[model samples]
Target: TDFEKEIKGDMLSSFISEVRELVLDNCKSNDGKIEGLTAEFVNLEFLSLINVGLISVSNLPKLPKLKKLELSDNRICGGLDMLAEKLPNLTHLNLSGNKLKDISTLEPLKKLECLKSLDLFNCEVTNLNDYRESVFKLLPQLTYLDGYDREDREAPDSDAEVDGVDEEEEDEGE
Candidate 1:
């Protein structure tokens, strides 16, 4: 088959359970779309798909051994709670440059006690408003809250803001 210089997509596709790391960045899927790794390669420990517009991945099969998943630069905007259920062994995750609306989707990750690092650099995150405070509730074993950089575990302030003491209480009733 000289016309076929080389064919090697499905070859690696079926070898999922045997594979711990699979990288198919920028590969055109059967739908003639360049996106994240096809669901055919589901059970991988390390997955990296940079600069790919992976819009949806709800069809992926279970990946129990998956320890690390890197899907940066994609349009992934779905709840991430399912991942914790599917990949209990997940420890490191990177989803930078994607459209992540909220971190509440990560609440389920508390069960993944082994998780150590996570990255969501310039996604659709606005501020540490919604679930950022909740992230500090526990995660005692978490060394690096986001990415490899360890976060400063600051305690939440309990006292309300002291705007201004009442003049009466200040003995200014003169």
Candidate 2:
């Protein structure tokens, strides 16, 4: 199918069968439905489909190894339960700039045990009174909401930490 070919063309490697990360940003989805994907992408760990006009995730394939998913800037309104079922191991999910409005719309995310970091920036839900508290209560499994935890502590950036370590090592060698 054309969808499969598009995914293949975007793959980092020529071998699409063993893709671990795929970015299809700005590509149009079939009316918010993803088709032509298969279990052959079993090794896929990270996927970014930003601005794809997705309205639902019901058609997403089961990706056991998936840890991070970027669906920011889409039209997804609800039905996150499909993510818990399809991307069971997902730890980080970026739904920033979507149409999520009420807290109840996020209730289904409780089923995702591995989910830790969730970003809902620019969503309507962020405007609710006590939004942070409500979301933390709803999804107890989430360690960080919009990059901060219940205590308002920011999540550590791995890349920055690695760079800091490198700088310290260079200083020690001086």
Candidate 3:
């Protein structure tokens, strides 16, 4: 489809099975569990559940095609190992603003061999000594941490110019 399918700020129960992208940020769950998700979403590629009050991700349904998942601003303390199986193809994961406290808590993520980018902004683990070095050592497969690499190079912005397409040049041509 030409248009991206996105469901933002909506109740989980109202989500469509065929949607490829879903954003349910700020939708709270009573038991801190992901409800209303099923294995029926075979086509889903991206999912964002920021600020959803989730304390654990044990309830997530299998999403084999999922490549990017955003679970930032939640209350999650751990139980991330399940994501390796549930979202097997996940390449990017954002767990910023959560309750993660130690680098040991992220050891389970090593199973996610495809994960290239991981963001842990505002998490307690970031305050640990040698945080960046520890994480890079633990998850050697990771290419970017908190948007930067072990070499301290920042990841390119998604909106940055590509293939020399400049707005000023386009306007001048007009």
Candidate 4:
């Protein structure tokens, strides 16, 4: 209901004129397809379409100024390649809980040098072997994945004993 009203160019143009953030969570676009809506928000820096039942990203309009986009909990199966090509300035993206299953689907994201944070939690691709390493290699610019940062993923094991603690002294202290 709200999404339909928002997608109307005249209405959206008037609404967008006053804000840089567009939140359309839980509002399905026409026919579960995402088209013609994004072009209206040319100046938007943040856009959220969470749980909108989007089936594809093929028709996503070029958003030159958009830095953060949230498409979590949708039905998107693929199209990240087109997304990277279109939104070269994007820095943060959330595709969690979608139907994405292949890590190769993310290959095009390597072109997004500005992308720093990506969330793919609950997607089938997370189950793949070496998933974290693969994603890290694919998007070297990413400092955060899901909710974890680079240091969190790369931190050394914490089970190693301290160098200077003697067994006898440790036992005595206890």
Candidate 5:
């Protein structure tokens, strides 16, 4: 029975706003993972997980009060459809660095009308011309686009090549 009140939990309900922005540079893996963050915090405004091995985030209850969310890096693949249905209050989302061959898997997030910022860095994103147009066509509230930036990392194109994007430019950008 090593379980006791050795550590007292903080009350997130009293917080004026719950904005958990976890921005790390480089986190290799989630080996030996432990308990997840209990978001009982009513004031939770923002939540970010940068450079962390966050594979799957299940049971994301409705956060009508949430404003911003940033989750970059780590080996997260699949189940994006489910994620889009949840987390309605997210305004800013950064999904950079991961194994994303097809971004269409994440189109579900377009339902988030409050979404403003979106980042998809080094995600093997193909068909940005099509994808970008699709997103712009769908999500009317989006403001800042991430991949189209000149400083964005270059992804290898297959047979066809889009203007304003070249292998040489990608090298410089990356």
Candidate 6:
């Protein structure tokens, strides 16, 4: 199909004029890579490249307004640093079901202050020790991790701590 061939080639740059959101899922991209494609969408805010078999995220043009990106179920091994550097306004990212193994690969994300939500649900990195705590410490601005909110965890802890400490200790004093 021309559409498939166009998407697989650098021809995308010619079509995208003012596209804000683009979804190119399951394209079975050649070489499992996406290069020189993103540069076309100048006004792109959201991009979903799910299940595209992408192995790298290089040659991506800086998208200042990009807020959300979905690269789930791809072969992406690394390049979070590039993502963090290029998309400063990115707030949500889904890298689930990938080949990512080391949590340190996410260290670059600390610089992304606007990033609030990250989903690494089925990635191998999720098996690391203290994954949640480590991620929270690295990116404190993140209110959500793997779908769980910081407020949700803190709220229950505060309630349990107050009840256990004040009520239990006061009762024991009497």
Identify the leading candidate in terms of TM-score.
Answer: 2
Give RMSD to native, each candidate: 13.9, 6.1, 8.3, 9.8, 10.1, 9.9
- Candidate 2: where are CA atoms >4 Å away? 1-14, 158-174
lDDT of 2 by residue, 1-174 (tens): 999988877773446568889988988889666655555678998888899989998878889999889999999999888988889988889999999999999998998898888999999999999999999999888888998878887777822321112333334554
lDDT of 5: 0.57
| TM-score for candidate 2, residues paired by index | 0.81
- Any runs in candidate 5 off by more than 4 Å, and if so which? 1-36, 59-62, 126-129, 147-174
lDDT of 2: 0.84
Q: Which lDDT tens digits does candidate 4 get at residues 44-74?
A: 8888899988887766777888888899998
Residue 128 lDDT in candidate 3: 93
- Residue-pair clashes per candidate: 1, 0, 0, 0, 4, 0
Q: Clashes in model 6: which pairs?
A: none
Better of 3 and 5 by TM-score: 3
Sort the predicted structures by TM-score, highest score first.
2, 3, 4, 6, 5, 1
Expressed as tens digits, the lDDT of each residue in 47-96 for candidate 1 is 66666556755544567777777777877786566666777777777777
TM-score list, all predictions: 0.60, 0.81, 0.80, 0.75, 0.61, 0.73
Model 3 regions more than 4 Å off: 1-17, 158-174
Q: Which ten residues in a row have the lowest lDDT in candidate 5?
A: 155-164
List candidate 1 segments past 4 Å from native.
1-17, 28-43, 129-134, 138-141, 148-174
Clashing pairs in 5: 18-43, 18-44, 18-45, 19-46
Better of 4 and 6 by lDDT: 4
Higher-TM-score candidate among 4 and 6? 4
Candidate 6, residues 1-174, lDDT tens digits: the string is 998987766555645756888888777676755654555677898888899878876645678888888989988778778887789988888999998898788888888888878889899989999888888888888877876765454322311322223322345555
